[model samples]
Target: MGEPNTILHAVRVSLRMSQDELAQAIREDGREHGEPNYCAKRNVQRWESGDVRMPRKIYIRSLERVTGLPIEALGFATPVFGTRAAAQAPANGQESARGEVVEMGATSAPGGAVPMTKHNDHGTLSGIWLSRYEYHSSGRGADFTGEHFVVVIQHRNKLTVRSLPEASSNPDSPLTMDLTVDGNVVTGSWREETAGDGYYAGAVYHGALQLLLEPTGRKMTGKWVGFGKDFDVNTGPWELTFKDASTSKAAMDRYNHRP
Candidate 1:
């Protein structure tokens, strides 16, 4: 609605980060660099809700102190007070939610699908970073556990797959992934090169998963499918969850570093 506030909102959303995670990241930065922490979780919430305006100096210092990112990386906030057309504009045919028409990169896919470039604002797709669950079919047919991570990549609605791995239930044998999210869909692959012992042969494993995400009334939901080759095991599923990249990233990070 006013100077600075709108900018903060854009930065948060663009980062695909929760207010709490962002706050934690900022706190970690302060502790790492020996700077006084600027805001707590509640403060971030208030800012997101437009409850208060943090000082400009604090904002700049926080960015530098936390992410070590350049100030210019955060763009100018478009004033919230604008006509529907003006508000929806996003500079390249990108339609703002408020009805302003901006120039957005052309998407071959209909209905506002643009290719996802990176996992974060940093513009580098490291991999799937987190995992929420692992599903297994019960001995009884047609029974399954909760949803799990499915990574998919696409170019103009055409499906392309990377790889898929099961979420590790045992601390001993863990699963992780690196993912690519292009717009509403995500694509990436991972493998557990070496198993603990030769008993299973761990064998060469590879697979791919894909997800299609849509915003529900208040939340986002996605449909997913997966196909995989695990040593002598091969399985495919037509259903899965559409998890955010952050979740995948965290999972992969843990899997890769697990002993």
Candidate 2:
């Protein structure tokens, strides 16, 4: 094909996703943006092969949301005309300047958009948070507490949380929460993969979650209902508290060392 979009290919590889996976992610992102996209693996193949230098406007925006990178940074050439640039810019009051999509109410620095932290009071759900949950285990004969370091990211009205491993050698149980926000209520679903050698024998569990966000926006208290190892319905308390506004080395170390 053309010169081979190495940058696009490298990003997909870095994400540990195959062509089909990337396509699916882009499609989901597009749907969230109110632009339904039927992206297929063949489309991704064409993009990586440089056969399609620039995708449609919806696909470009979806790629930006999925990768958190500007289109130009992803090896797409910038539009020369102002009208085209304006059309491709982020909608709903978000702006694109110098190929950077600036979040609403976010100030631009000399080089890039200012990093939105908890101090900004922008009501953003992006940062590191401490997640604590309780579950009753019949085998243990009592309730047990489990905690993890999670990274939260907010895109529009959606919030996604993923558990971070405490250490390279000792990985955390894989957990993911996807929630939608409406005023003070947060409703979502959670899925977790247990450790293979654990008591449950690596079973996968998932369920619904409903939480209430405090007025301060720093904490969320909720309840989760899921099926237990014995196939019985179980409900438990779950809480997420703001820990760090940034995932710096120090913040990660502090959480990692928690007993």
Candidate 3:
């Protein structure tokens, strides 16, 4: 029973491996050195519990040979290896200091031996959610006076549909069109219909809402044509800001600038 043996057992338990597994691994490692009988489950347990002392060289080498981990990493018994003091020392000095320190349960960093960071989702137009917007002209003598809304497109039936929300003046038959992003083309028409003489009337509408990505999410941008029985409308360019539950500004900047 010795300090080295006790530490070795602690390392084995931390790794969640049983004594038999470690013993077999050790036996396999010993074969490389023509000392094939060096490991057994019983022997490993006695060595780990400090019931017996391990040959220093065999003990150190067996760590890597048995567990496929580096010798320095098996210094799991110490908790000060990850401290700022350890980082300032030379490599060999750091290893020595780490090895000498007794197990204090704080040697390992908060992120284990390796660093792990979580990914943020934002700025990408993940096809998991939907978004929409509307545009209203704000000038006199403007060709378009009524409010024109742009619905962020949702994929459906091999087509992308972008529509304007129905206005109180006229609910059904709102401005809308189908767009194909891959080809950069839009196909559809604006048709005006009359409901009752007072609340609704036949107005002209044209202009396909183009897709655009904004700081928010996928947005639609386009112009309004006219408000008559017969009007000619055309497609306009708009950016659809990609939006998702996890989209972020930093992510968007990186995505747009990536090579």
Candidate 4:
């Protein structure tokens, strides 16, 4: 009816929610790198009214989830985050001002928020993505029964993941694994520690995860291996998709790390 509302404001309206409702929802998502009350209603007003230059990556990521709107549609100019800036980011769990995810930056528009920075050769691995793997032994013939719930965290180019078995006694327990990306492919390994035995037959569980980026850049598919005494003993396939497509809403597992 009237002139179109500002991009951020329009998104909030499209969801039939008030600014306070969206603000409260964003605060609860709670980015590990964000501050207390960071997404206050006043801040939302600022972003909606064009008072702020660019929303930081943390808020951008959280708001995407809160509003179910793509960050690019919010209309802020994306800024490129350099290596120096990333290295200089706060070390006390606080994050620096980052817009673009350098090595693994935005490729398209469905999964996470789009970076406002100039396009570059490097790609970014920021934002949330769900990982699913069904592990089975070579001769076990169990129809890939070992299922692990996994989530990936991409900050700049460095990546980390926390995974736990679906039937695990310790669902609160997460195995911290790290990986690096080469082109669309990502590979890494982590050693796991648990009080009880693993989901597999033996008590030991250590493995490598490989992911191939889809053309849409929002999804990845790969295989993972659960190595035992001789290495690469147990193997299976895994898939990673954005939060919206995931049945497992356990998307924020990255913040579960303890000091």
Error of 2 at 230 (Å): 3.0
Identify the candidate with maximal lDDT.
2
Residue-by-residue lDDT tens digits, candidate 2, 1-259: 3335555664554344679999999999988879988888987887776555567677788998886556865654333324766666543222233222332222322123343232323378777787888898898799777677776766455576766655212244666677778778889988777778877677788999999999898999999999987789999999989977875545555665333
- Predictions in order: lDDT: 0.39, 0.67, 0.38, 0.52
Whole-model alpha-carbon lDDT for candidate 1: 0.39
Q: Residue 147 lDDT in model 2?
A: 75
State the lDDT at 89 in candidate 2.
53
The ten-residue window of minimal lDDT in model 4 covers: 101-110
* Candidate 1 lDDT over residue span 1-259, tens digit each: 2122333443443344567888878767666767646556765654444333222344446765553234433323223324778544343322233423333223422222343334422232222322333334333335333322333332222222222334332322333233355655655543333345632246434455554434321112332334333234434433333334442445443433311
Q: TM-scores for all candidates?
A: 0.28, 0.53, 0.26, 0.40
Positional deviation of residue 16's Cα in model 2 after best superposition, in angstroms:
12
Stretches of candidate 4 exceeding 4 Å from the true structure:
1-124, 137-141, 145-151, 164-173, 191-202, 229-232, 244-259
Q: How do these models rank on TM-score, best leading?
A: 2, 4, 1, 3
**How big is the positional error of residue 163 in model 4, measured in Å on the Cα after superposition?**
3.7
TM-score of structure candidate 2: 0.53
lDDT of 4: 0.52
